[model samples]
Target: MPMNRIQFQPGLSMPEFFEQYGSESRCEAALERARWPEGFRCPCCGTWAHCVLRGANRKMFQCNACRHQTWLIAGTIFQGTKLGLTIWFLAIYLISQAKTGLSALALKRHLGVSYPTAWLIHHKLMHAMAAREERYVLSGQVQVDDAYLGGERGGGKAGRGSENKVPFVAAVSLSDEGHPLRVKLSPVPGFTLKAIAVWASTNLAVGSTVCSDGLACFSAVTEAGCVHQPTVVAGRKPKE
Candidate 1:
């Protein structure tokens, strides 16, 4: 038997995050290093030699060869932002480093920002995350379950037709021993064959086996080049 070389590491806490990215200048330098590791090259023209101009707020990078000017946060998510770099870093830490994740209202209170600002930041960050997730494919044996999220609307309809039920599919990839490896919870318009096919195409890997309850729409995974195994629940039940 061999030990798994993969190791799980914990995320940075608030104190640790502050120690590393505590000030705006530190955040700016870190972002610059991450974006242009070799050196600052002019976006307009490919030149390495550049000078820094201290503006009212941000520092502009001027290429000596091409005379093109650019800022540290230009062309990035932080572009044309009134918020400070430290605040943006804090928001990223809270949204990503948290174990259970944080809500927009909670982020608003934690960052001391207004509701609209917190909501906007959270929305953009989450949208970016989902866009990134679209590039990944779930491999190996996958267990999939159909589900509906959201609570019932007060004094409104109930059951599947309830106004509050947002249909979704929860799929989890399993290791060789049947342990859950990774999970994907995606919202779909409905549990129809078309929706399931679309979800399978986007999320599941080709030739992977999908296990699910005996649902007709589960067959749609075959259209995505995956094998489907439907399970039947045998029990004594009386229809009321």
Candidate 2:
């Protein structure tokens, strides 16, 4: 798609074009502005350094105190990036400006780069979303379930209960008003008493009422100290 067709609304924009146009130069400039809002100083000696950029080293700022020149982008995440300032800025713009997230494939097409590069950039960004990654103890009228993530392994009786599966426990907490709050997930090697206890103890807070299936494993784990309210699910029937 053409650059002009990709419209940006400063804060509220679409996903695809957002990734295509975010420029790294813009990002670097902003970084510089934010880092040195008052003025540029020699990072090494902390002096109100030279006015002239000096020589052909565009990235370095000259220091008058010790005459030491250091890279402006040093220690920042952008220091080692190989892409141009414009391209990097455009990539950042595309990712941040978009309301709904852009897929890696869409970003690859827009950025004219390899699939791996686009995927890496997107994943790297997703890693930084800390607020979205918070873990909470789901309490008060909750539903807990076990899910198998990854793949099953081994064969037959040898693998009966030891299928080398990555099992995950999940809990969804509801507010007093019954609005959903948050869910917690944890993966384990086996669905044992020890495993269940660990998962629950870490994710569920003490004294927070819990509702779960009436299983021996859950029984043993619940004794690890939280107050548990059991609901048995047999065949297709659920008995509270």
Candidate 3:
């Protein structure tokens, strides 16, 4: 079967955006609303503090019990980041909509932030994605396979021809009841028994029935207590 890829178009004009929220006070109000959607709750005392004005009559609130004064942009991803609110919104919009992943340089130009700052923010967002996705586990019937992702070889005599290739083993689990082999790929140093054993132990459960083409490294699977079914080819016939 053939596969299709997706492309995204640019989105939103600044004037169209500002026409919705054009002023400093308007922007601040929007930030306050987003940061405190449940109204003002005192961070110190955890009570719903009364909304009060800050310097120049700003829209910040003073904590009722502890009198701990704070703004809406406190203690979140936006906290302590000095980039303008408009740029922050644009940065978020661009990254969320991007499919091939955005470069720090791209984000810098798109959001008008320094290169170093953009890199920092981009890495921070990537960390956030991993943290969020780490909660889910792959379960049920799984597919075990090795994909050679070798790269140009390097280091000593081991870095010779076929160096451009690396070994990757993965186990993709069936979705719902259908077996689609949704494995997680990990780079194996080589097709060595030690490498395969470590990868299998980490990626497969003790009860999983793994299928392979009789690779020696996979012998450890049986030793590890899982049933291994090796597909066989003998002479002109097959052995069950």
Candidate 4:
């Protein structure tokens, strides 16, 4: 029984993250720097000069030219979010560091926020990630497979025909030596042709060779401008 070794990537530890972005002010300042790398350019008036309103704790940036006012999280995904930036940052950290992924319930317990807020935060971040992945095109040889979750039943029908099963696609970009370079596990509504096509269009790179099990939906990859090679697993013995 040989042990399977895993390569771990370097990441920000909890103590390090807290030391830097522990406070709300620190997080706000970080966001401001990220939003305006050069300097503060008013979103509305595009003015570089702005004055911070002093008084009731909330820092409001008022454009000197147009007098337009905005806050740190304004016009971004965190806009109108009542939760503090620290909580959001913690959620992001937990989500990123988790191997199996953190559920909304788990997030609620960890962040001490309500279930609804946790759910909202989780989905918002997930949706933003999905949107961002739309620009990725996996080049070179790739392997793809269909995966399912929540398809089990104790006293009823089970397996693929089971109710409440969630379908997702698992794909990996392979190097020339047949090693996996990157992997993606994306959830889809269902494993239909349209769904697979949509996933392929967004997640896969054009002109890549895709290898997959003999699933009909995988043909949709060709429609997305990629080559598909389906391997028939039926009646094939393990390691054959």
Candidate 5:
């Protein structure tokens, strides 16, 4: 049996992560570099000339050309955060590195913060991730399927009509070599044609080929100018 290179790729170890971003100064320096890769430029005046001033908690930069002042965290997701840069960076690292996803309760325990603070951090990070993902549209050969979050409750509804289930569409774009490229999992109102059409229009590029299960709503991809290829699964499970 051959090992899958992608699945076995090297990643940052916990010790290495802490070593790189252990102190507040280190985290602040990283943020500074990320925000201003080509050196500091005033957001308001867009000038390279700036002066550093002592802020209440951190250093502030003032543009010499327009006298505009801003903090390093200003206009970023870290803005208005009361937590230290080290805490926020650790939170980011934990959330991003979690393979099975991290809950607010788990984050609170990990970061030693209150439940409300953990919830806020989780919300902000998840929202930022979603906002970033919204910029991309699936193109090329795309494989799509209808799925549901949550499971069927004991005396409630079963199967697709389960009350506990939240309907969503899952799509994966493939590279030219048939390897998966990118994936999008989007929640929808229901499996109606109108809902699928709206989601397709938003998430798929025009003229892309969309391969999906024989769920009739998948035909709505055509409304978004995509070519649809439907495969009937009958009663078999996805893995089968």
Candidate 6:
């Protein structure tokens, strides 16, 4: 068996992360660059001319045209945060880079912060991630499948009808070269045509070509203005 390229790809090491964003100043600079790639533009007046005011805690940008003042972290997930940018950046790095996901308790220990602070940080980051994901709709050639979470308990029903199972729809968009792009895994109430139609309307863009197994419910994607291409599994395994 060969190693999976995606799983084995090189990633930023702890030392490398520290080298780039170890200091508060470095993290702040990085955030500024990310927020304004071209340069500072006042959010209120959209002017590039701004003056930096030295606050006791952080720098504030004042637009010369509109006299509007905004903090570096204003209107962002890091807004009004009392924590240092370095700490927040480190938390982001840890949460995003963790393979098995990082818990709030573990994050607290890592950042040497209070449990409540860590929990709040974790919640905010997760909410930000979810909000960003909600804006994305898959387009072009998309592959979709029905999935389930959990398994039957000792005394419960088995297989697809198991009481413990929660149904979900898994969709992956592919590029022109057939490379995978974005993926969406959304939970549905059940594998009914109505459920599939609702999920398709929310997740798929109009005119997207959706390929899925011969599940009758998937035909409902057509109701969402997407083209559904069904493939017969005929009891063969997915790999086959």
What's the lDDT for all of these models?
0.86, 0.65, 0.66, 0.83, 0.90, 0.91
13-92: candidate 2 lDDT, tens digit per residue: 54543453355444556667867898788766789956546333335677788887766656654566666655555666
Model 5, C-alpha of 214: deviation from truth (Å):
2.6
10 residues in a row with least lDDT, candidate 5: 231-240
How many Å off is the CA of 227 in candidate 4?
A: 2.0
Clashes of each: 0, 12, 11, 2, 0, 0
* CA RMSD per model (angstroms): 5.3, 8.3, 6.5, 4.3, 3.4, 2.8
- Which regions in candidate 1 have their CA more than 4 angstroms from the true location? 1-9, 98-101, 153-164, 174-182, 231-240
Ranking by TM-score: 6, 5, 1, 4, 3, 2
lDDT of 1 by residue, 51-134 (tens): 999786997899999898898888778888899999889998889866688999999999999999999888888887887777
- lDDT of predicted model 6: 0.91
lDDT per residue for candidate 6 within 84-104, as digits (tens), equals 999999999999999899999
The C-alpha TM-scores of every prediction are 0.77, 0.53, 0.55, 0.73, 0.88, 0.92
Give the winner by TM-score. Answer: 6
Question: What ranges in model 2 sit over 4 Å off?
Answer: 1-79, 82-107, 129-141, 150-164, 220-225, 234-240
36 Cα displacement, candidate 4 (Å)? 2.1
- How much does candidate 1 score in TM-score? 0.77
Worst 10 residues of 4 by lDDT: 1-10
Question: Model 5: which residue pairs collide?
Answer: none
Q: Which ten residues in a row have the lowest lDDT in candidate 6?
A: 231-240
lDDT of 4 at 194: 90
Q: Once superposed on the true structure, which residue ranges of model 6 sit more than 4 Å away at CA?
A: 235-240
Residue 193 deviation, candidate 3, in Å? 7.2
TM-score of 3: 0.55
